[model samples]
Target: MAAPDRPAGGGRMLTGVTWAVLLLGLWLWGRDITDGSGGPAPTTGDVAAVGRPIGVRLPPAHAPLRAAVPERVEIPSVGISAPVVPRGLDRGGGIEPPSFDTPQTVGWYDGGTKPGAAGAALLVGHVDTETRPAVFYPLSAAHPGEQVRVVRSDGSVAEFTIDDVQVFTREHFDAQKAYGPRKDGRAELRLITCGGTYDRATREYTANVVVSAYLTGGSGAAA
Candidate 1:
């Protein structure tokens, strides 16, 4: 996503001002931090820790084995239908390229953390195409109480009810709020993507849109 900014030709300085406001908003929200260990390195002890809300102590980095990619993700309100694949960070910690051959994909922060064992499962997608529309194109328009479903390889489906949506500047990516401990400590999911306006010069989006929801029910297995 392009960072928010004024159009190159000028005339929309207000857009730049909005970006400034967003920056301030991010500072207030606190920045996200990547845990050095990607997913929960599950151990036998870690398996017992599962089912708790976010913030439970995760297993060591080498604990749990890597899970398979999700089969499908369905969001009725925004019309998002995509397969989930395991996405990890490149050497630089930026989003690695999507595995096109995968049926559906969701990224795991190989350097920062994993999902399902504990904490919030962080999933992200492109809101639109650089030149053509893509999945999550209607993300900014999603409302609270919407439904998001993820079917894992185990033939179990996890359903989540949208709690709220928030937009934050790239500089202010609040990891804790977006992927950190929650009040209820129940299993939760955080879907993220670029939003706001496009910045042609920066070639990045000005803001990130985060959709938060909690798991309702399913086969009770981790995806």
Candidate 2:
């Protein structure tokens, strides 16, 4: 089904200070990425359980694979399988998502850590389009323990095991928690999309849904 009309600018950007904060966080995240950084544990602040589901057993992280361009992403449980395109920062220093014309596509931050690398790899998609549900519209429904696979250009698949699902309101958005590495020595992934209640007045979603996962098991070899 279709959603309400979006602003002429686009679907994801927030307003004024909130937008600035997101941009700053993203910029710092890009600059701070390293093979292994003793970062904080990944958790959603609003959830009492702190992003972990009750008693779900997650797998241990696999050693990080070499850097390679991502070709596609697949989340079988949610029926998401889409082409991934590399994107860079916009003039305002914010990671630019795919153009609205390609709502079925996912955008990867080209300047940041690549999927299967030592740091968290960032992927973003649209929740919906002007005419229908987009690639990651059902992303919030994904649960911990599910798998997110990123097929890389090196002919290997980087398999990430979901450990957390979080929804951060603009006021409570913690970019580091959302974008940083969950564990210091493993490959991680961050899936993000617009979510929560839609604000007609602002023409935006009130929050962003972030899914955190780390490298689990995969087949093939990295180049």
Prediction RMSDs, each to the true structure:
12.3, 5.4
* Model 1 RMSD in angstroms: 12.3
* Model 1 ranges off by over 4 Å: 1-69, 97-117, 219-223
Best of the candidates, TM-score? 2
lDDT, candidate 1, residue 107? Answer: 44
lDDT of 2 at 94: 84
What is the C-alpha local distance difference test score of each model?
0.49, 0.75
lDDT of 1 by residue, 111-222 (tens): 3323333445666655433333445555656656677777777666777666666665555455455455464436666776556556666555556666776666555355
Model 2 residue 149 lDDT score:
94
Model 2: which ten-residue window has the lowest total lDDT? 34-43
Which ranges of candidate 2 are over 4 A from the true structure? 1-24, 34-52
Q: Per-residue CA lDDT of candidate 2, range 1-223, in tens?
A: 2333455444443444434555666777876753333001123455322346678998888988888999999999878999999989988778776777888899999888899988888998877655567788878778899999999998999998998887766676677887988777788999877655666576666666778899997778872
Residue 14, model 2: lDDT of: 40
lDDT score for residue 1 of model 1: 28
Q: What is the C-alpha RMSD, rounded to one decimal, of candidate 2?
A: 5.4
